[model samples]
Target: MDTLELQAKAKELRQEIIKMITAAGSGHPGGSLSAADILTVLYFDKMNLRPEEPDWTGRDYFVLSKGHAAPAQYAALALRGYFPVEELNGLRKLHSRLQGHPVSSKVPGIDVSTGSLGQGVSVACGLAKGLKIDKLPNHVYTMLGDGECQEGQVWEALMFAAHYQLDNLTVIIDHNRLQIDGQVEKVMNIEPLDKKLDAFGFNVLLVNGHDIEAIQNAIDKAKTCQGRPTAIIANTIKGRGVSFMENQAGWHGTAPKPEEAEQALQELA
Candidate 1:
């Protein structure tokens, strides 16, 4: 997809996120919305994927370390043809594959089942290392929430990724600056994040998370860096693309009412 098409797809993803969350009457819409463009760029433009062959060994992998944003990943997967888009409405429902958090066995595109903070990156690092051992060209990408950086395990995973020098691994941090409780800074600051990532031996690239071209460029650049993993600090707005929800902490895990959903859809349109 071209830049315009990618942007359009991102809007569609955001619309689907709001619809799914509203229908399910529960979800982390704020983070999902914030990460829409990042997911769009990866699943639609960057990753080596086979929607019909989810288990293809040669394919690249993506892990939503911040798994509460499963709606964003779900929208991307459906649009990418991993499953029927209609299945999205069953999000968070009993017996549904599209649960609140992604499950690897149940979901078609997801490789790592996540929800426990700070674990998915470790899994992603493992995948990268395994691919290296197998002499595979495939890459591994994982998205982490800014708030999730507060966890000690995240740093441990970073250290591991660095020590192993998993150059094929790309860590995309959705730095939306807000979590469920409040602003990430007020709750627990992870400031100078880029510098910290640099200190951890990552090839760090910072970009506006909403800019498709910039995001694609950063991912491409990560592919060229040798001997260390890459970390893309995507500065984004929580609840992006919706007027009332943008940057609002309250919307982090709150489903929108019907009227609010309508308004959000209109805004996205």
Candidate 2:
């Protein structure tokens, strides 16, 4: 898809995210909205995926390391034809495959079950190493929240990726600068992130998370990088595309009410 088309698809994903979260009565919307463009570009334009064959080994893998943003991934999966779009309304409901987080066994397109924060990237590192062992050309990609960077395990995973020279791996950080409590800096500063990643041996690229052209270019650059993993620091807004919610940390885990959802959907439309 071209830039306009990708932006439109991202709007659709954000709308679905608001709808599903409101229907479920509780789920993360801020982070989900922030990551919509990144997910849209990945699933719709970059990744080698088979919606009809989710288990296809030849396809590239994506892990939503920031699992609370499952609504965004679910929206992307449904729109990409991995499952019925109607299933999106079942998000976080009882017995729904579309839970609050990406579950590999339950969800068709999810390659890993993620929720505990900082662990999904470790699994992604394993997948990259395994692909390397098999001599496969497939690549592995994962997204992490900037707040989640405070976890010690995340650093360990990055160290592992660098040691193995997993160039097939691309890690995108949704640098929205907010968490549930407040600004990420106030809660726990993770400044100098790009420098840290570079010190860990990653080919780091910084971009505006909402800009499709920049995101596409960064991902393409990651693919060409050799001998080390590439990390894209995607600077974004917490609740992007919605007027009232944009940049508000309070929306991190709060579902929009019906009226709020209406306004957000209309804005997205």
lDDT of each: 0.96, 0.95
Candidate 1 minimal-lDDT segment of 10 residues: 179-188
Residue-by-residue lDDT tens digits, candidate 2, 128-161:
9999999999999999999999999999999999
Task: Looking at model 2, report the run of 10 residues with the lowest lDDT sum.
Answer: 98-107
What lDDT tens digits, residue by residue, belong to model 1 across residues 37-98? 99999999999999999999989999999999999999999999999999999999999999
The global Cα lDDT (0 to 1) of model 2 is 0.95
RMSD of model 1 against the true structure: 0.6
Error of 2 at 134 (Å): 0.6
* lDDT of model 2, residue 175: 99
Count of clashing pairs, candidate 2 = 0
Candidate 2, TM-score vs. the true structure?
0.99
- Each model's TM-score, in the order given? 0.99, 0.99
